[model samples]
Target: MTTRAAGVATPRRAWLGLAVLILPVLLVSMDMSVLYLAMPTITDRLDPSGTQQLWILDIYGFLLAGLLVPMGNLGDRIGRRRIMLAGATVFGLASVLAAFAPNAGVLIAARALMGLGGATLLPSSLALISTLFPNPRARATAIGLWTAFFAGGTALGPIIGGTLLHSFWWGAVFLINIPVLLILLLAGPFVLPEHRESGRGPMDLPSVLMSIGGMLPLVYAIKEIAAHGPAPIPAVAGLAGLGVLVAFVRRQRTLAEPLLDLDLFRRPMFRLAIVSSTVGMMSLAAMSYLVGIWLQSVRGHDALSAALLGLPGAIAVFAVSMIGSRVGRRLGTGRAFVVALTVAAVGNLLLLGVGVDGGVGFYIAASILIGIGDGLAFPLVSELAVASVPPERAGSAVGISETSFELGNGLGLALLGSLAALVFRSGGDFAPTLGETLDDAGSDTGLARAASEAFVSGMHVATIAAAVLLAATAIVAWRTARTQPAAAVGVSAEPVGARH
Candidate 1:
């Protein structure tokens, strides 16, 4: 029996709810990676500008990151379950629109709406786990499983999308979500419990607007700088975004009930966890693009073939997340994450050796290591990041971490993607752009070989940069573990009363 009275409810029914909660995350995570292989198809069909192409990839994350805080807090005050249901509806509707969108602008808008729906879904599911599990160790394990499904979705996206693309059209990926949404809609009310912060003040509408305004501009600046190099417009956008952020921070100080826990940063584990997860996620994001290019651009593989190449890495990631939980429990959670980061660094460094002829075998081997490292590290960091706050504020805590992930994905596309692009252009063996690089190489055996080799050379530099960043993140995590020393793993295991 799991009682609702608050002191660690041990309800058997919560496991069923957990299964239900995994649905939204599984769908959302799949959305992240599924579109990558489909991008080339979209480009051909939509005939978008370079900037528009980036927007189609980025807008979902941008809108989702910008709205997370407001949405998370809203869930806290009104109810997590209600917010989740509303988001599911939005996500389902957005998926249909995105599937049928005729132009770049409409597709971008649809993706942004999906992002909005994601903002509501991701945090609520994670937060609910905080209340459902009573024992610390069990909670940690549960968090690991949640991260596993999330990881699995990203891994499976390519194969699933690839298979669909092989047989059908690009829109088939979006259409697959319809049936999943129906299940969530019907089962959610029966198993998912509702939680709300009763004493919390009304939602801050102005703050919500400010967050979106500030983030949209900042991300625009970053993306433009990547595509066209620095210019006056991007510079102005950057400053304006910074100013808005400052104003938002000040506004939080004045509000009787702030939207976020401004003081959450005071905890060392909390701060480091965000930094660690964001950096790790950034590497993964960069790889997402590079892998697609490697398959389609360099190897001349179709979309399904490209997506299939990622299957091994995806399996490694899902396996690590599922099986590493016990190992993480045995080791201090902080130390486990640090070890995983070190492993990931080693994996990134291996890319330095890849050449034009670097066989699929080489790529697969490197990807497996990278996948295992990320799979092990990400979940531990996420669990720590959210668990640092009080149970009641779980939504806000998850919102902050999830925001970092969204921002990292965007930044990865801009920064690392730009670095690789720059290196590719400077080779002077081919034209400055990928389109011309391929066109100029067409029908000429020597030029095509040179172009392929040049692209790999660019990848070498990007890999070095990624390795250095991962090492730095690992060092930061290591030092924090040395000093802070985790308080306790599992305090007590108490069962609660509830109905099945």
Candidate 2:
């Protein structure tokens, strides 16, 4: 173990290391974007059924989210850099496999493998920053950069994929990953220092299995319920998942060395931070999920144009996140979130005017506002989540935080997005999904126009629901901030191994 002055400024080497850490962030996000943009192409080539296509698209996120906590714990137990390097290796190989798969099943298998590799990369990269930047403020800034780059990769994914798909095959998008992974593999161990718990106990297999098992079914249940309305099996699966998670928690309470230190939630600050992050991310995901479809399916834009529209919002997130720490210092984390959420609420409200008519201006305005709000608030919550734990246990803590973000993506799509679908179909007969609804309206100009109008109606409902959620979150944050204890320590100078 090593120690440093509590207030020591981050060194140049750590900045360099931060650059290396952003690779996985970009890789995972870019991969998501490319997959999304390449879906039709994949379906065309693989000729998968609707269910198989859904699995192909979602399995990556599902497995990645499910394994995050365990993988984060694994990194803490073994070593951050080692897992990072290993994850990158696996991710690169999986990309190659996915690029040239013989069939849908093989591609699904390859995507699941990519999910494991993604799970390893995120928590390890985030936790490594704790070791690198001992100062709380510097760490927040670094996280801001990480968030910005993540937004950049996501925004670029579709753009890049569209370009590649135009000139080459869908595999070209996967090939783009090869160079990035090669660079990360070569630069990582040389630049990023290894960090892990010094006295980790025996590996806890039950908890590991429980965590993965608990998450997989729960997420699948949520997605299925959203996609197909309430059903007996998913509802039962959800309950069963709840039971497994309860058991997992019970075992953690009795274990000498818990896989995740459940005690961290004891702090009000940590708990509040997690909630804020989850809800904030939910808003972001719901926005992207809705607007992406709204643009293409409703507004009659190409995927490339829709991707272009998303770029401004992504840029706003990057700009605001980079400066978010300063905003937090001025307003306090709680107030910063409140303000950001209000902005987000307003952003959502602006989109209430988005319709089958000419309201692209309002949509674009809403995009910038939402981006600004997320930029302002996202770092504050994430920074607090990372700061709440000691660097030695950083992987697990950050894993929980990261998981909350993934949960937001899952739940936002399920809850708010589903509600919108329900509202749209309530008035008349409609297809199961927006894409399907529009696709079924093929060649009938009136039906296409009517479908767009109906989808916009749903979009309005979703955005309004989103706004209410953000407003409620802001109020809760206000109360929490008022009562938050000042002793909420983000980090300490205890002899954690110094990043060399």
Cα RMSDs of all predictions? Answer: 4.2, 3.9
For model 2, the superposed segments whose C-alpha errors exceed 4 Å read 1-10, 33-54, 101-106, 135-137, 162-166, 424-431, 485-500
lDDT of 1 by residue, 1-500 (tens): 44433456567787788888999998988887778778777877886766777788788877878987888888888899999999999999999999999999999899989999989998999888887776665677678888888877877777788779889988888989989988989999999999887876788888899988988888788777766689999989988998898899899878866665566666666666677677877787777777677778777788888778889989998889875666656666567768888888888777666566656776778788988998987686667655666677778778888787777777776677767877876776566545456766669878777777777877777777888898998888788778745522221111110000
Q: Count the backbone clashes (under 3 Å) in each candidate.
A: 8, 0
Residues 244-349 of candidate 2: C-alpha lDDT, one tens digit per residue: 9889999998987777777767766567667776787677666666776676667767666766766777778778878876777776676777788889899989
Whole-model Cα lDDT per candidate? 0.78, 0.76
Residue 253 CA displacement from its true place in model 2, Å? 1.5
- Among all windows of 10 consecutive residues in model 1, the one with the lowest summed lDDT is 491-500
